[model samples]
Target: MKRLLAILFFLAGGLAAELAHPVQCTLITASGPQQKRRKAQ
Candidate 1:
């Protein structure tokens, strides 16, 4: 039972990580374009 629970927790953690990576990347890249515009000004 403990092993099963551990596996479930690990999977959930990975799923959460996978879900967050795209959002984090989007936020970083979104700011990059804005920064370039600011530099041009």
Candidate 2:
């Protein structure tokens, strides 16, 4: 249970960090989604 809570806290921290800076996230998503969606076909 402690391990699970630690992982959750880690993910939450990373999410907060990302939300604090969105340009990199938008660029990654924009470049990744096209290739991923094409491959999913």
Give the candidate number with the greatest TM-score: 2
lDDT tens digits, residues 1-41, model 2?
Answer: 99999999999998998899854655444444444345554
lDDT of 1 by residue, 1-41 (tens): 99999999999998899887744554444434343345565
lDDT against true structure, model 1? 0.74
- Extract clashing residue pairs from model 1: none
Error of 2 at 26 (Å): 14
Question: After superposition on all CA atoms, what RMSD does each candidate show versus the true structure?
Answer: 7.4, 6.8
Clashes of each: 0, 0
| Candidate whose lDDT is highest | 2
Q: What value does the lDDT take at residue 13 in candidate 1?
A: 97
lDDT of 2: 0.76
- The reply for model 1, stretches above 4 Å from the true place, is 23-41
Stretches of model 2 off by over 4 angstroms after superposition: 25-41
Tell me the TM-score of each prediction against the true structure. Answer: 0.52, 0.53
